[model samples]
Target: MDLTPYVETLRRELAVAAEAGGDDARELAERLTAPLESAARLTMLNVLSAAADEITRELAPGSVDVRLRGLDPDFVVTPPPADSGAATEPAGSVEPPRAPAESDEGGTARVNLRLPAHLKARTEEAAAREGLSVNAWLVRAVSAAVDAGGTQPRTAEKARTVGQSFTGWVR
Candidate 1:
């Protein structure tokens, strides 16, 4: 009575049936009800500590390399092959998702910058060409650069708000 193969086989069959019903609404709801659910959101380190304990045990120390890896508590897992006789890694093994570790700036990291007066004026003139004030222009410029795949960490919300205030002051 080798139940290992039979029990696992039955488990797989049941999982396939359960999955055919549709997407995991429980998981989706967890993600969708965010900000609202953000308060309940688990940190990745905590999640990794709990969510996939079995898989993490298999990883070597320092194998988990990531920056924004801790940003998402979720990990994606791939299923094992359906062939029963094959000796392979079990299904439901977890893998971490992460952002690239390096940037295109050739390892020169960004620092807080104070704009020089002439450079600021040049930026203001460019903004003027776009019918924007200097601060607004810089915000828009930074946003555009981000949209083009730059990974700046600075928040533009404050800059944009100040720019709008400047708009009023100029009047």
Candidate 2:
């Protein structure tokens, strides 16, 4: 069946509907509506029936009859494939799993305490001794701490001090 005219009719109707009640589209709706209705009125009922049949066959179960709406009702009956009835359940059932807690920014406090005045001043002195701004100093210190697996700059530096002390002794 030639579905082109019906498809064009639907398209025109949609275009008219899309433009309805808008000032810019007022003329367009008027121009398209008549042609759309004319095409719709000329559509073959058989084509619509065929499209509906194709949709039904795709959706219905393959192993059972699917009855559809009508006066006497239409049905599509499909017998089970030869070995379908003999299928057995697989051995194991999976246990439901627990969902892990969500992680979000700033959810856990990594920075334990604000530096005390003496410690803060020492930190500033340490940065100046290393020729860096406080931010840069902290960044370097953090990198060192992470590399040496410590929480604080002093702990990371302690590892180096201990290493040097061991190497410099008994020379």
Candidate 3:
């Protein structure tokens, strides 16, 4: 959204308010307005982000995100799938969920790693696609790889077919 108009309106209001105090106050307001523009934009962005989060909560399984483009924030909304609660996975699909397990059995540790800008963006996109945060997705991935002792991590297809059965008549 274009914030120029809103920021301008704020500046105008500040100027009008300072007018009551005479020339000194008016000059100070003009000087301060230039610095305050950035602060105002940041505050506005924060408000937009909070609003998007609240809307997302009310639209669970769907989401709203505020993306910054230059100085403006844009809203991106992902509506719930038309088939909502039908199988979450496509038929014959074998991708495992990457959500982090909720377990109190282990202590948490923090590690710092840096990646190229492109890789970081890709990781964020992958996490968003799976409805998980980047940290959670990374933790799940690391757990899978470590559990395999550096061998190839098992895929969902291999992990589930053993001792699984369907006991129903097929038409």
Candidate 4:
């Protein structure tokens, strides 16, 4: 998304706020424009908007509310309600849910992992050679690893059987 216009709007707002303080404040605000623009470009829009709102509150203390445009209308961005019950936790205090046990079954879950580009390429190559999707190949590999207690040596016979099982299941 093109953030240039949004950055410009923020710069203008800051400049107006600084003008109320005098020449030094205006100059400082002007100097902040480049860094602010960089931050806006690098950050996700919702996060950037939240941060900008916080900064506005700090600077003017309830006199100004900074709201970003172009977000979905249905997406309401508001502060979390103050905790009033045991069931409610303060924002940023809750822990993310732990991953399920490896042996757990039924529903599938998605996980994101960062792999080196070359490693990803090699895995893709191997998956292509096996005529299987990367995800299916990885699932089989992990299942095999667990079943074999991580010590079984890879052999052509085992590989052939694994491939056959996979194709048979697909068919």
Whose TM-score is higher: candidate 3's or candidate 4's? 3
Candidate 4: give the clashing pairs: none
Better of 1 and 2 by TM-score: 2
Please identify which of the two predictions, 1 or 2, would achieve the higher lDDT against the true structure.
2
Number of the candidate with higher lDDT, 1 or 3: 3
Q: RMSD per prediction, one decimal? A: 23.0, 26.8, 8.9, 16.8
Q: Which stretches of candidate 4 lie over 4 Å from their true place?
A: 43-122, 126-148, 160-171
lDDT of 2 at 149: 67
Better of 2 and 4 by lDDT: 4
Per TM-score, the best of the predicted structures is 3
The best candidate in terms of lDDT: 3
What shift in Å separates residue 138 of candidate 1 from its native position after superposition?
1.0
C-alpha lDDT of residue 36 in model 1: 32
Candidate 1 lDDT over residue span 1-171, tens digit each: 122344345445555665655678444443444343333333324445453433422331112222234334334432221334224433533221121233355531234669899987878776555444343345445545555464434454323222223221111
Question: What lDDT score belongs to each candidate, Candidate 1 first?
Answer: 0.40, 0.44, 0.69, 0.52
- For all predicted structures, in order, the TM-scores are 0.22, 0.24, 0.55, 0.35
lDDT of 4 by residue, 40-122 (tens): 65565656556554443333211122344563212222232223443554443433112123344443345786889999998
User: Which lDDT value does model 1 have at 64?
Assistant: 27
State in Å the error of residue 87, model 4: 44
| Model 3 agreement with the true structure over 1-171: per-residue lDDT tens digits | 999999999999999999999999999999999999999999999889879766755554456778999999998776633454336544664444332343567534559989899999988987676565565557656766665565543344344421133211123
Backbone clashes for every candidate come to: 0, 0, 0, 0
Q: Distance from true position, residue 133, model 2, in Å?
A: 0.7
